[model samples]
Target: MNKKLVSMFLAGAVFLGTLTGCTQPANEGKQGGQEAVKVGMVTDVGGVNDQSFNQSAWEGLQKGEKDYGIRISYQESNQEADYAPNIEILVDQNTDLIWGVGFKMGKAIEEAAENYPDFKFGIIDYAYEKTPENVVGVVFKEEEASYLVGLIAGKMTQTNRVGFIGGMDVPVIQKFQYGFMAGVKKANPDAIVDVQYANAFNDPARGKAIARQMYQRGADIIFHAAGDTGTGMIEAAREEGKFAIGVDRDQNDLAPENVITSAMKRVDNAIYEVSKRLADGNFPGGTTIVYGLKEGGVDIAPTTSKNVPQEILDFVEAQKQEIIDGKFTVPSTEAELNAMK
Candidate 1:
C-alpha cells in the first residue's frame, strides 16, 4: 500500500518475511462492527512455505491485512486433489475473493467460479480462453527477468557453461529456459546453457542431484525455476562452492556464500495491488493483467552485485531499458529463442 515499498522492490531491493504454518481466517478484523472483507488463497502443490511465489503471495496478503484491515487467509494444496476442495473451503467461508496461486489451479478456479456465480475469483499464471465475468487472471513475462540473470551467467561463468533446472516442463518454465538461453547467447555465443526439469515443484533431493550433475559437467552457474526444489539447488551450490540463481524471491540468504542472485518475480506486489484494487471497488474480473519488466513485476535481485561485476550489471540494466523501451523482445518460447540465433 505504501509507494516506498513498491519503489524498493522495483529498484532491486526487497525484504521477504518468513511465514510458517498458515490457516484460514476465523472471521476476525471487523470494520465498523461488520465482518471485514476476507480474501483467501489456494496455493499449488508447493504449499505456502515453499519460499517461492506461494510464500510471496501470502506476505502480500498479510500486508493487505495490515494496511487495509482485510481478513486474509490461505489454503495450501499438497496435491492436485486438494485444489477444488480448498476452493470450496474458502467459498464456504464466504471469502470476498478467492485467489488460485498457479497455472495448475486454472480449471479448479474456473469450475468454482462457474459453480458459485456470485463470488469473485482470481488466478495467477493462467489465462482462461473464455474468462468468466466473475474471474480475473494474472500472468507474468518471466522470460524478461530471467534473461537479465542469464546475461549475468554468461558474463560471469568461468566454464562458459551455465545450467537451468525447472520444477516442471510447462510453458511457464520454458519461458525461463528459453529466455535464459537467449540471454546467454546474446552475451557469449560460445557458451552453453544446459537445461533440465525435475517434473515436480517440491523435489529438493532431485533438484540437488541435478545441480550436482550440472556442476560436475563444468557448469559453474545454475538457475532454477523449481519451487522448494530450488532450495536443494542452492544447497548444492554451497556444498560445491558454485553459484546458484534463485527464482520467485530474493533467496541469497539461502546460501550467502554460494547463491549469486535471484530472479525476483514479485508475486507479492501483484497480490497486494490486486487486493487494493478490490478494496477500491475496482475488482478486475473478466480481464487479464500481465506484469513484466516494464510493469515492475520482475527483476534481478539486489544481491546480484555481490557476485556480478559492475559492467555486467550496467549491461543488463541497459538491456532492461531496451526491453522496456520496446527496442527488443526477449524470447519466451522455443521458436522465438531459435529465431534469435
Candidate 2:
C-alpha cells in the first residue's frame, strides 16, 4: 500500500469512538447466537453493475461483509423514481444500516433519515452542514484526483486537443470537469479541452457518439465522468486508437489497452470502514466525513504508469505532495477554474 493510503486510514481514525451511529438489530444469525449486523445498499439510477461509481460502493460493502461477518445486500434503482421506494423497502426489512450510492439520491436519503430517526443511514458524494442524528455523509475532493489525470492528458495529447464528457451538470460532476480543465491548462496552456455532458448517467450509445465526434475533431485523449456512459467512451477510445481517462474507480480492466488511467476515489475503503464502525457499535451519525488528497480519499489510479511517462508521474507526485501539505488547492468549481485563467 502507498504511504499516502496509510495516512488516509489514520485521518479517519478520529471518528472511531465507543458510541456512534446505528445499533445492530436483534435478528438471529446462522453462525453464532449473536445477531448478524445487516447492511443494505441503495444504488442510484445506474444500478449496481455500472462498472463505476455504484459498483465501487458495493465493493466496499462486500469487503465489510467478509471482514466483519456482517450481512450485506443491495437494491438497484433503475430510475429516479426508484430511490424512495427502494429505501423504504430496506427500512421495512429492518436493516441495521442503509447506504445510498450517489449524489442523485441525496434528497431521498435525507428524507428517509428524517422519517426514521431510530434507523441509521449513510450516503456518498453529498454532505450536510447539520445532518440528522441518524445519518452519515461521505464526500470527496474529486477535483484533486481529476486534476492529476488531467495533467497526464495535457502532457500526452498529440493533437493539443482533449475532451471531457460528464454525466450531468451536477456539482459532483463539475468537480471532475473544472479540475481536469485546470490541470490541462496548467500543464499545457495552449491545449484545448472540449467539454460536453450526456445529461444522463447510463447511456453508452450517447457517450460513444460524443467520443467519436471528439476523436474525429482532433482529440487524441478524452476523459469521462459519466458513469456507465464512460464505459462506452472507453470502448470508443479502443476503437479510435486514442486514450481515455476513467473516473470514480480504476477502469483499466474494462479496456486495459485504451484506458490510460483513472481518477480514483477510495469509495470501497470508505464504505468498508463505515460498515465496520456500525458493526462495532459506533456509527458516527449526524456527521459528514470529507476525504481529499491528504486523506487518500481520491487519487490518480495506479495504472497510470502503463501509459504515462516516468517524468510526468514524478511531476504529478510532486504536485500531490504539495496539495497534501496545503501548499496548493485544486479547483473544484467552474468559477474557481476560471479564476486560474
Model 1 lowest lDDT segment of ten: 12-21
lDDT accuracy of residue 304 in candidate 2: 83
lDDT of 1 by residue, 1-341 (tens): 54333334422321132222235554486876776778889898898889887998988898888888788888778888778767776776678999999999999999889888889999999988888999999999999999998899888999999999999999998998998998899999989988999999998999999999999999999999999999999999999999999999899989987888888998999989998888878998999999999999999999989977799999999999999999899999999998985
* Clashes, model 1: 0
Which parts of model 2 have CA positions greater than 4 angstroms off? 1-33
Across 1-341, the per-residue lDDT of candidate 2 in tens digits comes to 64334334432431353211222233335335677888988888777889899899988888877776788877777788777766766676678899998988889999888777888999998897787799999999989999999999999898899999999998999999999999998889999999999998999999999999999999999999999998889999999889999988999998888899999998898999988999889998989999898998999989889988999999889988989999888998878998875
Which pairs clash in the backbone of model 1?
none
lDDT of 1 at 271: 89
TM-score of 1: 0.92
Tell me the lDDT of candidate 1: 0.87
* Model 2 score (lDDT): 0.86
